[model samples]
Target: MLYDLFWQPFADFAFMRHALVGCLALALGCAPIGLFLVLRRMSLMGDAMSHAILPGAAIAFIAFGLSLTAMSLGGLLAGLVVVLAAGAVTRSTQLKEDASFAAFYLVSLASGVLLVSKWGNNVDLMHILFGSVLAVDDMALCFLAGVASITVLTLAVLYRALVVESFDPEFLRATGGGGAWAHFGFLILVVLNLVAGFQALGTLMAVGLMMLPAASARLWARELPAMLAIALGIALLSAYIGLLLSYHADLPSGPAIILTAGLAYFASLGLGRHGGLLGRWLRGRHLEA
Candidate 1:
């Protein structure tokens, strides 16, 4: 029965195929970035940036009249601007990083919503909020693919510096690598991923995909590489399974995908041997004897 439901749709429909491929691409691109974000304790920054893209998207719609390419580019630029501005503010002022991020994103979010409301295009807001993967066209797919490739390549080249800076910026500075710029570059890549993911996952949950699997991987792995590999594996698995479920169950693709990733996170929290709650409980019981 399950095979009939799943295989028949893929065999018969084009949209399902697009959704599956698109989601997989998103997972591959976003998961590794998620690992670094989690390690750097900047998960909330992802959330802020996701919301911050709204106004840019809204303005793009108003100015360019619903050109997806224009809107996406505009939103991407907005996200990068916010990231840089946040950094500048944090460095030049007394505000902490989190405080700066919160202020910038909240203001951006509110401005976007207000502008969209004023422009009388509330319908587009749904697309900005929840996404519609089934609506993805060949152009969007190609764009996502390019963004994914660039994101993965950038991360690969900068992996060592990012890892070092994440763990110990002082050590990196001592080694004369200019850890600050490296850190800045890493965040720029993250902002790009968040922008790319906005189309597939939307503002409400784009960062969810970027954070949950990496968070889950942390339960079992101590080293950064192992954690990243495990996170990527879990993310890919979630996308495949979630797409299948969405196909058979006729659910919204993005949220279904996110829920699948969330389940993996919860399972890891419970069953992981390193620090999982279940593992700890079992060890305690065993030691009581």
Candidate 2:
């Protein structure tokens, strides 16, 4: 029974194996970026950027007819445009950063839907909005793995700058200009990972995998290294269990994985040691005793 439920799907089907690997890659690549996003209080930013890349992919689809390279480049360009425009506005105007991000997110999402509707078929639109991980081939797996490697390497270089910027940007700025470059480089990493993930998980659901695990880990951990470890572990577990759930229940792979991550988030919320409700209750009982 255990073998049938837990292990047979991947053994029987290559698609399941591919999807399992792809989801793991996505989780690995997205966790650190997501954690930093939460640390910087930019949880919504991931969602915004995910949608922000859609129009670029849509344009590429219209022009290049479903060419992956074109769509990837277009999406990267589009994401960078929004990031630059939003950052520019935040620096130049009275608008707060979240508001700037929100404004661009709405415009980009609406425009993407409109463009895809006008030029592409419903199938194309669905593919962009909700990617099919089950369809991931070896080439796609390579892309996801490559993105993960690049993200890990980039974060290692940017680690000190980003952490310092997160806790004390002024201090980092006082020392040198590394903070500025680090900030920009971090944003680029965010967009890069989002673009890579969007191809497998869809724009809407990609950030779910990214942000949910990080947020959940935040409730459980206080230190950055611990948080990153917990988040990556949660993402990987969710990917594996979610794929199994999808296989047995005939559910969508992306949403299933995200839902599993959501389950983890809620579980963390209730039972986390940092400030979870259950932990607080337990502490109260101990005090009374």
Q: Using TM-score as the measure, which candidate wins? A: 2
- List clashing residue pairs in candidate 1: none
Against the hidden reference, what TM-scores do the models get?
A: 0.95, 0.97
Q: Candidate 2, which segments miss by more than 4 Å at Cα?
A: 285-289
Model 1 residue 28 CA deviation (Å) reads: 1.1
RMSD of each: 1.5, 1.3
- Candidate of highest lDDT: 2
Worst lDDT 10-window in candidate 2: 65-74
What TM-score does model 1 achieve against the real structure?
0.95
lDDT value for model 1: 0.84
**Steric clash count of candidate 1:** 0
- What's the C-alpha lDDT at position 220 in model 1? 85
lDDT of 1 at 143: 80
Task: Name the weakest run of 10 consecutive residues (lDDT summed) in model 1.
Answer: 2-11
The digit string of per-residue lDDT tens for model 2 on 228-257 reads 999999999999999999888999988999
